[model samples]
Target chain A: MVPISYYLILSGILFACGVIGFLIKRNIITIFMSIELMLNGVNLSFVAFAAQWHHLSGQVFVFFVMVVAAAEASVGLAIIIAVFRTRETLNIDQVNLLKL
Target chain B: MLHLVLFLVFGAICVAGAVNLLAQNHPISSALSLVVVMASLAVEYLLLGAEFVAAVQVIVYAGAVMVLFVFVIMLLNAGAEERTQGSRVALVLGIPGVLAGGLLVAWVLVQRTNTPEVPLGALPGFPKTIGALLFHQFLLPFEVTSILVLIAIMGAVVLASRPEPKMKVPEKES
Candidate 1:
Protein backbone atom coordinates (compact mmCIF):
# COMPACT_ATOMS: atom_id res chain seq x y z
CA MET A 1 0.00 0.00 0.00
CA VAL A 2 1.26 3.44 -0.87
CA PRO A 3 1.77 5.75 2.05
CA ILE A 4 -0.17 9.01 2.20
CA SER A 5 3.12 10.85 2.48
CA TYR A 6 3.91 10.27 -1.16
CA TYR A 7 0.55 11.61 -2.22
CA LEU A 8 0.95 14.62 0.03
CA ILE A 9 4.41 15.31 -1.35
CA LEU A 10 3.22 15.13 -4.92
CA SER A 11 0.30 17.39 -4.14
CA GLY A 12 2.58 19.85 -2.44
CA ILE A 13 4.94 19.91 -5.39
CA LEU A 14 2.13 20.43 -7.85
CA PHE A 15 0.52 23.11 -5.74
CA ALA A 16 3.76 25.04 -5.47
CA CYS A 17 4.26 24.77 -9.18
CA GLY A 18 0.78 26.12 -9.72
CA VAL A 19 1.40 29.06 -7.43
CA ILE A 20 4.68 29.97 -9.09
CA GLY A 21 3.19 29.53 -12.55
CA PHE A 22 0.15 31.55 -11.61
CA LEU A 23 2.39 34.34 -10.43
CA ILE A 24 4.89 34.26 -13.26
CA LYS A 25 2.93 33.38 -16.37
CA ARG A 26 1.95 36.40 -18.46
CA ASN A 27 -0.73 34.83 -20.62
CA ILE A 28 -4.27 34.99 -19.29
CA ILE A 29 -5.06 31.40 -20.21
CA THR A 30 -1.89 30.13 -18.60
CA ILE A 31 -2.82 31.90 -15.42
CA PHE A 32 -6.25 30.34 -15.64
CA MET A 33 -4.60 26.96 -16.01
CA SER A 34 -2.30 27.56 -13.09
CA ILE A 35 -5.32 28.32 -10.96
CA GLU A 36 -6.91 25.06 -12.07
CA LEU A 37 -3.73 23.26 -11.24
CA MET A 38 -3.77 24.81 -7.81
CA LEU A 39 -7.34 23.75 -7.23
CA ASN A 40 -6.61 20.24 -8.44
CA GLY A 41 -3.68 20.09 -6.06
CA VAL A 42 -5.96 20.98 -3.18
CA ASN A 43 -8.45 18.36 -4.28
CA LEU A 44 -5.76 15.73 -4.13
CA SER A 45 -5.00 16.61 -0.54
CA PHE A 46 -8.65 16.57 0.32
CA VAL A 47 -8.94 13.03 -0.99
CA ALA A 48 -5.82 11.96 0.78
CA PHE A 49 -7.11 13.24 4.09
CA ALA A 50 -10.54 11.86 3.45
CA ALA A 51 -8.94 8.47 3.00
CA GLN A 52 -6.81 9.02 6.04
CA TRP A 53 -9.70 9.82 8.35
CA HIS A 54 -12.22 7.38 6.89
CA HIS A 55 -14.52 10.37 7.13
CA LEU A 56 -16.75 11.35 4.24
CA SER A 57 -16.43 15.07 4.86
CA GLY A 58 -13.32 15.34 2.74
CA GLN A 59 -15.06 13.74 -0.22
CA VAL A 60 -17.94 16.10 0.29
CA PHE A 61 -15.54 18.99 0.22
CA VAL A 62 -14.02 17.68 -3.01
CA PHE A 63 -17.42 17.58 -4.63
CA PHE A 64 -17.95 21.22 -3.77
CA VAL A 65 -14.46 22.03 -4.97
CA MET A 66 -15.20 20.46 -8.32
CA VAL A 67 -18.39 22.42 -8.69
CA VAL A 68 -16.52 25.61 -7.89
CA ALA A 69 -13.77 24.70 -10.36
CA ALA A 70 -16.29 24.25 -13.14
CA ALA A 71 -17.84 27.60 -12.38
CA GLU A 72 -14.44 29.24 -12.24
CA ALA A 73 -13.50 27.79 -15.60
CA SER A 74 -16.60 29.07 -17.28
CA VAL A 75 -16.25 32.58 -15.94
CA GLY A 76 -12.49 32.75 -16.42
CA LEU A 77 -12.61 31.62 -20.02
CA ALA A 78 -15.40 34.02 -20.82
CA ILE A 79 -13.40 36.94 -19.48
CA ILE A 80 -10.34 35.87 -21.43
CA ILE A 81 -12.29 35.59 -24.66
CA ALA A 82 -13.85 38.99 -24.10
CA VAL A 83 -10.43 40.50 -23.50
CA PHE A 84 -9.04 38.77 -26.54
CA ARG A 85 -11.60 40.38 -28.83
CA THR A 86 -10.92 43.89 -27.63
CA ARG A 87 -7.13 43.84 -27.20
CA GLU A 88 -6.20 41.15 -29.75
CA THR A 89 -3.76 39.82 -27.17
CA LEU A 90 -3.97 37.70 -23.99
CA ASN A 91 -0.65 38.75 -22.50
CA ILE A 92 -0.95 40.09 -18.97
CA ASP A 93 1.76 42.64 -19.62
CA GLN A 94 -0.33 44.11 -22.43
CA VAL A 95 -3.59 44.01 -20.47
CA ASN A 96 -2.27 46.75 -18.23
CA LEU A 97 -5.09 49.26 -18.46
CA LEU A 98 -6.85 47.62 -15.53
CA LYS A 99 -3.66 47.51 -13.50
CA LEU A 100 -2.98 50.42 -11.19
CA MET B 1 8.18 -2.17 -7.03
CA LEU B 2 5.36 -1.65 -9.44
CA HIS B 3 3.97 1.23 -7.42
CA LEU B 4 7.35 2.91 -7.22
CA VAL B 5 7.86 2.53 -10.96
CA LEU B 6 4.43 3.91 -11.73
CA PHE B 7 5.03 6.75 -9.37
CA LEU B 8 8.29 7.66 -11.03
CA VAL B 9 6.73 7.45 -14.49
CA PHE B 10 3.80 9.67 -13.63
CA GLY B 11 6.13 12.05 -11.81
CA ALA B 12 8.32 12.37 -14.86
CA ILE B 13 5.33 12.84 -17.12
CA CYS B 14 3.96 15.60 -14.91
CA VAL B 15 7.28 17.41 -14.73
CA ALA B 16 7.73 17.17 -18.48
CA GLY B 17 4.27 18.52 -19.01
CA ALA B 18 4.97 21.52 -16.77
CA VAL B 19 8.21 22.26 -18.58
CA ASN B 20 6.48 22.01 -21.93
CA LEU B 21 3.76 24.27 -20.64
CA LEU B 22 6.43 26.92 -20.22
CA ALA B 23 8.50 26.10 -23.29
CA GLN B 24 5.83 25.70 -25.95
CA ASN B 25 5.25 28.70 -28.19
CA HIS B 26 1.90 27.66 -29.50
CA PRO B 27 -1.11 28.17 -27.29
CA ILE B 28 -2.65 24.87 -28.36
CA SER B 29 0.44 22.97 -27.31
CA SER B 30 0.41 24.68 -23.97
CA ALA B 31 -3.21 23.75 -23.47
CA LEU B 32 -2.43 20.16 -24.42
CA SER B 33 0.31 20.12 -21.81
CA LEU B 34 -2.23 21.28 -19.28
CA VAL B 35 -4.30 18.27 -20.26
CA VAL B 36 -1.36 16.05 -19.48
CA VAL B 37 -1.14 17.58 -16.04
CA MET B 38 -4.80 16.90 -15.37
CA ALA B 39 -4.58 13.32 -16.58
CA SER B 40 -1.66 12.57 -14.31
CA LEU B 41 -3.68 13.99 -11.45
CA ALA B 42 -6.42 11.47 -12.20
CA VAL B 43 -3.84 8.74 -12.01
CA GLU B 44 -2.85 10.04 -8.64
CA TYR B 45 -6.49 9.85 -7.71
CA LEU B 46 -6.63 6.22 -8.75
CA LEU B 47 -3.59 5.49 -6.65
CA LEU B 48 -5.41 7.01 -3.72
CA GLY B 49 -8.37 4.69 -4.38
CA ALA B 50 -10.85 7.43 -5.11
CA GLU B 51 -11.87 5.79 -8.36
CA PHE B 52 -15.07 7.75 -8.76
CA VAL B 53 -13.52 11.12 -8.09
CA ALA B 54 -10.56 10.24 -10.31
CA ALA B 55 -12.91 9.38 -13.14
CA VAL B 56 -14.72 12.65 -12.60
CA GLN B 57 -11.39 14.45 -12.54
CA VAL B 58 -10.43 13.03 -15.92
CA ILE B 59 -13.77 13.43 -17.64
CA VAL B 60 -14.57 16.88 -16.34
CA TYR B 61 -11.11 18.40 -16.24
CA ALA B 62 -9.20 16.66 -19.01
CA GLY B 63 -12.06 15.76 -21.31
CA ALA B 64 -14.69 18.47 -21.14
CA VAL B 65 -13.14 21.55 -19.56
CA MET B 66 -9.75 21.23 -21.22
CA VAL B 67 -11.51 21.10 -24.60
CA LEU B 68 -12.99 24.46 -23.74
CA PHE B 69 -9.52 25.74 -22.91
CA VAL B 70 -8.14 24.47 -26.22
CA PHE B 71 -11.01 25.98 -28.18
CA VAL B 72 -10.50 29.34 -26.57
CA ILE B 73 -6.76 29.15 -27.18
CA MET B 74 -7.29 28.50 -30.86
CA LEU B 75 -9.99 31.11 -31.12
CA LEU B 76 -7.89 33.73 -29.42
CA ASN B 77 -5.02 32.92 -31.80
CA ALA B 78 -2.42 34.05 -29.30
CA GLY B 79 1.18 34.09 -30.45
CA ALA B 80 4.40 33.90 -28.47
CA GLU B 81 4.48 36.71 -25.97
CA GLU B 82 7.13 39.38 -26.42
CA ARG B 83 10.49 38.09 -25.31
CA THR B 84 11.75 39.63 -22.13
CA GLN B 85 15.30 39.87 -23.53
CA GLY B 86 16.90 38.43 -20.41
CA SER B 87 15.21 40.96 -18.21
CA ARG B 88 17.04 41.12 -14.87
CA VAL B 89 13.65 41.64 -13.27
CA ALA B 90 12.74 38.09 -14.14
CA LEU B 91 15.77 36.77 -12.32
CA VAL B 92 15.24 38.99 -9.32
CA LEU B 93 11.64 37.91 -8.91
CA GLY B 94 12.15 34.31 -10.05
CA ILE B 95 14.93 33.41 -7.61
CA PRO B 96 12.90 34.39 -4.57
CA GLY B 97 9.89 32.54 -5.89
CA VAL B 98 11.86 29.36 -6.43
CA LEU B 99 13.33 29.64 -2.97
CA ALA B 100 9.90 30.09 -1.48
CA GLY B 101 8.66 26.96 -3.22
CA GLY B 102 11.68 25.05 -2.04
CA LEU B 103 11.00 26.11 1.50
CA LEU B 104 7.45 24.86 1.22
CA VAL B 105 8.69 21.49 0.07
CA ALA B 106 11.11 21.35 2.96
CA TRP B 107 8.42 22.26 5.39
CA VAL B 108 6.25 19.46 4.07
CA LEU B 109 9.10 17.05 4.58
CA VAL B 110 9.78 18.13 8.15
CA GLN B 111 6.18 18.20 9.31
CA ARG B 112 4.99 15.10 11.16
CA THR B 113 1.84 13.55 9.76
CA ASN B 114 -1.14 11.75 11.27
CA THR B 115 -3.63 9.82 9.15
CA PRO B 116 -6.65 7.73 10.11
CA GLU B 117 -5.90 4.94 7.60
CA VAL B 118 -9.25 4.72 5.92
CA PRO B 119 -9.54 1.63 3.79
CA LEU B 120 -10.10 1.92 0.05
CA GLY B 121 -13.79 1.64 -0.81
CA ALA B 122 -14.67 1.60 2.87
CA LEU B 123 -17.88 3.53 2.33
CA PRO B 124 -19.75 0.48 0.97
CA GLY B 125 -20.24 2.75 -2.05
CA PHE B 126 -19.81 6.42 -2.92
CA PRO B 127 -23.40 7.48 -3.63
CA LYS B 128 -24.70 6.03 -0.40
CA THR B 129 -21.87 7.25 1.79
CA ILE B 130 -21.72 10.69 0.22
CA GLY B 131 -25.48 11.02 0.38
CA ALA B 132 -25.87 10.08 4.01
CA LEU B 133 -23.14 12.46 5.05
CA LEU B 134 -24.41 15.40 3.04
CA PHE B 135 -28.00 15.06 4.15
CA HIS B 136 -27.05 14.06 7.64
CA GLN B 137 -24.21 16.33 8.69
CA PHE B 138 -23.11 18.40 5.72
CA LEU B 139 -26.36 19.63 4.26
CA LEU B 140 -25.47 23.28 4.63
CA PRO B 141 -22.16 22.95 2.76
CA PHE B 142 -23.90 21.10 -0.04
CA GLU B 143 -26.34 23.96 -0.32
CA VAL B 144 -23.60 26.56 -0.26
CA THR B 145 -21.65 24.84 -3.00
CA SER B 146 -24.67 24.86 -5.21
CA ILE B 147 -24.99 28.56 -4.61
CA LEU B 148 -21.35 29.05 -5.53
CA VAL B 149 -21.79 27.22 -8.80
CA LEU B 150 -24.91 29.20 -9.58
CA ILE B 151 -23.18 32.50 -8.95
CA ALA B 152 -20.27 31.43 -11.08
CA ILE B 153 -22.63 30.56 -13.90
CA MET B 154 -24.14 34.01 -13.72
CA GLY B 155 -20.71 35.61 -13.68
CA ALA B 156 -19.72 33.66 -16.79
CA VAL B 157 -22.77 34.86 -18.66
CA VAL B 158 -22.15 38.46 -17.72
CA LEU B 159 -18.51 38.34 -18.76
CA ALA B 160 -19.14 36.58 -22.06
CA SER B 161 -22.03 38.86 -22.93
CA ARG B 162 -19.91 41.97 -22.86
CA PRO B 163 -20.52 44.14 -25.95
CA GLU B 164 -18.62 42.90 -28.96
CA PRO B 165 -16.23 45.32 -30.58
CA LYS B 166 -17.95 46.99 -33.52
CA MET B 167 -16.35 46.29 -36.87
CA LYS B 168 -14.78 49.35 -38.48
CA VAL B 169 -16.34 48.42 -41.83
CA PRO B 170 -19.94 47.36 -41.42
CA GLU B 171 -21.01 44.52 -43.68
CA LYS B 172 -21.71 45.92 -47.12
CA GLU B 173 -25.09 45.20 -48.71
CA SER B 174 -24.27 43.18 -51.82
Candidate 2:
Protein backbone atom coordinates (compact mmCIF):
# COMPACT_ATOMS: atom_id res chain seq x y z
CA MET A 1 0.00 0.00 0.00
CA VAL A 2 1.19 3.47 -0.81
CA PRO A 3 1.92 5.66 2.16
CA ILE A 4 -0.64 8.33 2.88
CA SER A 5 2.13 10.92 2.97
CA TYR A 6 2.70 10.51 -0.74
CA TYR A 7 -0.90 11.37 -1.42
CA LEU A 8 -0.72 14.32 0.91
CA ILE A 9 2.41 15.59 -0.77
CA LEU A 10 0.83 15.34 -4.19
CA SER A 11 -2.24 17.12 -2.96
CA GLY A 12 -0.08 19.91 -1.58
CA ILE A 13 1.72 20.27 -4.89
CA LEU A 14 -1.54 20.40 -6.82
CA PHE A 15 -2.90 22.96 -4.40
CA ALA A 16 0.19 25.14 -4.73
CA CYS A 17 -0.05 24.98 -8.48
CA GLY A 18 -3.66 26.05 -8.22
CA VAL A 19 -2.69 28.97 -6.02
CA ILE A 20 0.01 30.06 -8.41
CA GLY A 21 -2.33 29.77 -11.34
CA PHE A 22 -4.95 31.78 -9.55
CA LEU A 23 -2.40 34.50 -8.84
CA ILE A 24 -0.90 34.66 -12.33
CA LYS A 25 -3.85 34.06 -14.61
CA ARG A 26 -5.57 37.12 -16.03
CA ASN A 27 -8.71 35.53 -17.33
CA ILE A 28 -11.58 35.02 -14.93
CA ILE A 29 -12.39 31.60 -16.33
CA THR A 30 -8.86 30.37 -15.79
CA ILE A 31 -8.92 31.76 -12.29
CA PHE A 32 -12.12 29.85 -11.69
CA MET A 33 -10.51 26.72 -13.11
CA SER A 34 -7.66 27.16 -10.68
CA ILE A 35 -10.14 27.31 -7.84
CA GLU A 36 -11.56 24.00 -9.00
CA LEU A 37 -8.09 22.54 -9.07
CA MET A 38 -7.55 23.65 -5.50
CA LEU A 39 -10.82 22.04 -4.52
CA ASN A 40 -9.75 18.79 -6.17
CA GLY A 41 -6.49 18.89 -4.29
CA VAL A 42 -8.31 19.25 -1.00
CA ASN A 43 -10.66 16.43 -1.93
CA LEU A 44 -7.70 14.18 -2.56
CA SER A 45 -6.33 14.84 0.90
CA PHE A 46 -9.72 14.29 2.42
CA VAL A 47 -9.95 10.90 0.81
CA ALA A 48 -6.42 10.04 1.82
CA PHE A 49 -7.15 10.87 5.44
CA ALA A 50 -10.41 9.01 5.21
CA ALA A 51 -8.49 5.96 4.15
CA GLN A 52 -5.96 6.51 6.90
CA TRP A 53 -8.60 6.80 9.62
CA HIS A 54 -11.02 4.26 8.17
CA HIS A 55 -13.86 6.77 8.12
CA LEU A 56 -16.50 7.44 5.49
CA SER A 57 -17.08 11.06 6.49
CA GLY A 58 -14.30 12.49 4.39
CA GLN A 59 -15.63 10.94 1.23
CA VAL A 60 -19.10 12.16 2.10
CA PHE A 61 -17.73 15.66 2.62
CA VAL A 62 -15.99 15.44 -0.70
CA PHE A 63 -19.34 14.68 -2.24
CA PHE A 64 -20.79 17.77 -0.67
CA VAL A 65 -17.86 19.80 -1.92
CA MET A 66 -18.49 18.55 -5.44
CA VAL A 67 -22.11 19.54 -5.21
CA VAL A 68 -21.19 22.98 -3.97
CA ALA A 69 -18.62 23.35 -6.72
CA ALA A 70 -21.24 22.54 -9.34
CA ALA A 71 -23.63 25.07 -7.93
CA GLU A 72 -20.88 27.66 -7.74
CA ALA A 73 -19.85 26.95 -11.32
CA SER A 74 -23.32 27.56 -12.70
CA VAL A 75 -23.88 30.76 -10.83
CA GLY A 76 -20.35 31.94 -11.48
CA LEU A 77 -20.59 31.30 -15.20
CA ALA A 78 -23.86 33.14 -15.38
CA ILE A 79 -22.22 36.04 -13.61
CA ILE A 80 -19.34 35.83 -16.02
CA ILE A 81 -21.71 35.99 -18.95
CA ALA A 82 -23.41 39.02 -17.47
CA VAL A 83 -20.06 40.69 -16.91
CA PHE A 84 -19.00 39.99 -20.47
CA ARG A 85 -22.26 41.36 -21.80
CA THR A 86 -21.83 44.58 -19.92
CA ARG A 87 -18.05 45.00 -20.04
CA GLU A 88 -17.18 43.21 -23.29
CA THR A 89 -14.20 41.47 -21.77
CA LEU A 90 -13.28 38.60 -19.43
CA ASN A 91 -10.05 40.07 -18.17
CA ILE A 92 -10.04 40.55 -14.42
CA ASP A 93 -8.31 43.90 -14.73
CA GLN A 94 -10.92 45.18 -17.13
CA VAL A 95 -13.80 44.09 -14.94
CA ASN A 96 -12.80 46.40 -12.12
CA LEU A 97 -15.67 48.86 -12.43
CA LEU A 98 -16.70 48.08 -8.91
CA LYS A 99 -13.29 49.02 -7.59
CA LEU A 100 -13.18 52.44 -6.01
CA MET B 1 4.13 -1.40 -5.74
CA LEU B 2 1.58 -1.18 -8.55
CA HIS B 3 -0.61 1.10 -6.49
CA LEU B 4 2.25 3.50 -5.86
CA VAL B 5 3.11 3.50 -9.56
CA LEU B 6 -0.47 4.26 -10.53
CA PHE B 7 -0.70 7.05 -7.98
CA LEU B 8 2.52 8.63 -9.22
CA VAL B 9 1.46 8.41 -12.84
CA PHE B 10 -1.96 9.92 -12.31
CA GLY B 11 -0.58 12.51 -9.93
CA ALA B 12 1.98 13.55 -12.51
CA ILE B 13 -0.67 13.80 -15.16
CA CYS B 14 -2.89 15.93 -12.96
CA VAL B 15 -0.03 18.28 -12.13
CA ALA B 16 0.94 18.62 -15.78
CA GLY B 17 -2.63 19.33 -16.75
CA ALA B 18 -2.87 22.01 -14.06
CA VAL B 19 0.30 23.61 -15.33
CA ASN B 20 -1.13 23.61 -18.84
CA LEU B 21 -4.26 25.21 -17.49
CA LEU B 22 -2.15 28.04 -16.10
CA ALA B 23 -0.07 28.43 -19.23
CA GLN B 24 -2.81 28.35 -21.83
CA ASN B 25 -3.74 31.69 -23.36
CA HIS B 26 -7.17 30.71 -24.51
CA PRO B 27 -9.94 29.84 -22.08
CA ILE B 28 -10.91 26.83 -24.20
CA SER B 29 -7.47 25.34 -23.83
CA SER B 30 -7.49 26.01 -20.11
CA ALA B 31 -10.89 24.40 -19.80
CA LEU B 32 -9.68 21.33 -21.65
CA SER B 33 -6.68 21.06 -19.37
CA LEU B 34 -8.96 21.31 -16.39
CA VAL B 35 -10.95 18.44 -17.84
CA VAL B 36 -7.78 16.42 -18.03
CA VAL B 37 -7.00 17.24 -14.43
CA MET B 38 -10.49 16.24 -13.35
CA ALA B 39 -10.30 12.95 -15.22
CA SER B 40 -6.94 12.10 -13.75
CA LEU B 41 -8.15 13.04 -10.29
CA ALA B 42 -11.04 10.65 -10.80
CA VAL B 43 -8.53 7.94 -11.48
CA GLU B 44 -6.69 8.86 -8.33
CA TYR B 45 -9.91 8.68 -6.39
CA LEU B 46 -10.48 5.21 -7.78
CA LEU B 47 -7.02 4.18 -6.73
CA LEU B 48 -7.81 5.46 -3.27
CA GLY B 49 -10.94 3.25 -3.33
CA ALA B 50 -13.53 5.97 -3.43
CA GLU B 51 -15.30 4.59 -6.44
CA PHE B 52 -18.41 6.66 -5.96
CA VAL B 53 -16.56 9.97 -5.61
CA ALA B 54 -14.44 9.00 -8.54
CA ALA B 55 -17.51 8.52 -10.66
CA VAL B 56 -19.03 11.72 -9.34
CA GLN B 57 -15.81 13.60 -10.12
CA VAL B 58 -15.88 12.46 -13.72
CA ILE B 59 -19.59 13.00 -14.23
CA VAL B 60 -20.05 16.34 -12.52
CA TYR B 61 -16.66 18.00 -12.91
CA ALA B 62 -15.41 16.67 -16.23
CA GLY B 63 -18.84 16.28 -17.78
CA ALA B 64 -21.16 18.97 -16.49
CA VAL B 65 -18.92 21.70 -15.09
CA MET B 66 -16.46 21.65 -17.96
CA VAL B 67 -19.32 21.73 -20.44
CA LEU B 68 -20.67 24.77 -18.66
CA PHE B 69 -17.28 26.47 -18.88
CA VAL B 70 -16.99 25.70 -22.57
CA PHE B 71 -20.52 26.86 -23.25
CA VAL B 72 -19.88 30.14 -21.52
CA ILE B 73 -16.65 30.65 -23.41
CA MET B 74 -18.46 30.05 -26.69
CA LEU B 75 -21.46 32.15 -25.77
CA LEU B 76 -19.33 35.09 -24.74
CA ASN B 77 -17.03 34.70 -27.75
CA ALA B 78 -14.18 35.13 -25.30
CA GLY B 79 -10.81 35.74 -26.81
CA ALA B 80 -7.38 35.30 -25.31
CA GLU B 81 -6.71 37.99 -22.80
CA GLU B 82 -3.91 40.37 -23.65
CA ARG B 83 -0.91 39.86 -21.42
CA THR B 84 -0.67 42.71 -19.01
CA GLN B 85 2.59 43.71 -17.36
CA GLY B 86 2.38 41.96 -14.03
CA SER B 87 4.26 43.37 -11.06
CA ARG B 88 7.80 42.12 -10.98
CA VAL B 89 7.68 41.24 -7.31
CA ALA B 90 4.66 39.00 -7.87
CA LEU B 91 6.23 37.34 -10.87
CA VAL B 92 9.54 36.69 -9.20
CA LEU B 93 8.74 36.06 -5.54
CA GLY B 94 5.06 35.16 -5.21
CA ILE B 95 5.19 31.85 -7.04
CA PRO B 96 8.22 30.52 -5.23
CA GLY B 97 6.74 31.63 -1.94
CA VAL B 98 3.53 29.71 -2.53
CA LEU B 99 5.45 26.62 -3.63
CA ALA B 100 7.66 26.76 -0.58
CA GLY B 101 4.67 27.14 1.66
CA GLY B 102 3.12 24.06 0.14
CA LEU B 103 6.35 22.12 0.56
CA LEU B 104 6.54 23.17 4.17
CA VAL B 105 3.02 21.94 4.82
CA ALA B 106 3.74 18.65 3.11
CA TRP B 107 6.92 18.21 5.05
CA VAL B 108 5.12 18.85 8.28
CA LEU B 109 2.49 16.30 7.41
CA VAL B 110 5.09 13.72 6.43
CA GLN B 111 7.00 14.29 9.64
CA ARG B 112 4.02 13.29 11.73
CA THR B 113 4.80 9.86 13.21
CA ASN B 114 1.44 8.50 14.29
CA THR B 115 -0.31 8.21 10.95
CA PRO B 116 -2.27 4.97 11.02
CA GLU B 117 -1.55 2.34 8.42
CA VAL B 118 -4.38 2.18 5.96
CA PRO B 119 -5.61 -1.35 5.44
CA LEU B 120 -5.70 -2.66 1.90
CA GLY B 121 -9.07 -3.45 0.21
CA ALA B 122 -11.23 -1.40 2.51
CA LEU B 123 -13.74 0.43 0.35
CA PRO B 124 -15.09 2.99 2.76
CA GLY B 125 -16.33 5.21 -0.04
CA PHE B 126 -18.17 2.56 -1.96
CA PRO B 127 -21.47 3.75 -3.38
CA LYS B 128 -23.60 1.64 -1.09
CA THR B 129 -21.91 2.91 2.02
CA ILE B 130 -21.89 6.47 0.73
CA GLY B 131 -25.57 6.31 -0.17
CA ALA B 132 -26.50 4.99 3.22
CA LEU B 133 -24.51 7.69 4.93
CA LEU B 134 -25.86 10.38 2.66
CA PHE B 135 -29.47 9.48 3.22
CA HIS B 136 -29.33 8.53 6.86
CA GLN B 137 -26.57 10.64 8.37
CA PHE B 138 -26.45 13.51 5.91
CA LEU B 139 -30.00 13.73 4.68
CA LEU B 140 -30.49 17.38 5.57
CA PRO B 141 -27.38 18.51 3.77
CA PHE B 142 -28.20 16.40 0.77
CA GLU B 143 -31.68 17.86 0.48
CA VAL B 144 -30.26 21.33 1.01
CA THR B 145 -27.79 20.78 -1.79
CA SER B 146 -30.61 19.90 -4.14
CA ILE B 147 -32.33 23.12 -3.23
CA LEU B 148 -29.08 24.98 -3.74
CA VAL B 149 -28.75 23.50 -7.19
CA LEU B 150 -32.28 24.51 -8.02
CA ILE B 151 -31.58 28.05 -6.90
CA ALA B 152 -28.44 28.11 -8.98
CA ILE B 153 -30.37 27.05 -12.05
CA MET B 154 -32.89 29.81 -11.51
CA GLY B 155 -30.15 32.33 -10.85
CA ALA B 156 -28.30 31.42 -14.02
CA VAL B 157 -31.39 31.77 -16.13
CA VAL B 158 -32.32 35.05 -14.60
CA LEU B 159 -28.85 36.52 -14.79
CA ALA B 160 -28.06 35.40 -18.33
CA SER B 161 -31.42 36.27 -19.86
CA ARG B 162 -31.65 39.59 -21.62
CA PRO B 163 -33.80 42.28 -20.12
CA GLU B 164 -36.70 43.52 -22.24
CA PRO B 165 -36.33 46.89 -23.90
CA LYS B 166 -38.33 49.67 -22.39
CA MET B 167 -41.14 50.96 -24.58
CA LYS B 168 -40.49 54.47 -25.86
CA VAL B 169 -42.99 57.12 -24.78
CA PRO B 170 -45.06 58.70 -27.55
CA GLU B 171 -44.33 62.37 -28.17
CA LYS B 172 -47.13 64.79 -27.21
CA GLU B 173 -48.60 66.85 -30.06
CA SER B 174 -46.97 70.29 -30.32
Q: Give the TM-score, chain B only, in order for the candidates.
A: 0.75, 0.84
TM-score of 2: 0.90
Q: Each candidate's lDDT (Cα)?
A: 0.75, 0.86
Could you tell me the lDDT of residue B126 within candidate 2? 73
Q: Return the TM-score for each candidate structure.
A: 0.83, 0.90
Give model 1's docking category: medium
Q: Which candidate has the top score in DockQ?
A: 2
Model 1 agreement with the true structure over B56-151: per-residue lDDT tens digits: 888888887889888887777777655443335656887587778778776766685543333334332266666788787988887888888889
What is the alpha-carbon lDDT for the whole of candidate 1?
Answer: 0.75
- DockQ (C-alpha) of model 1? 0.51
lDDT of 1 by residue, A1-100 (tens): 4566666777777777776776667778887887887887788888877777666677778777888888889889998888887887887777769732
Q: Candidate 1 chain B: worst 10 consecutive residues by lDDT?
A: B116-125
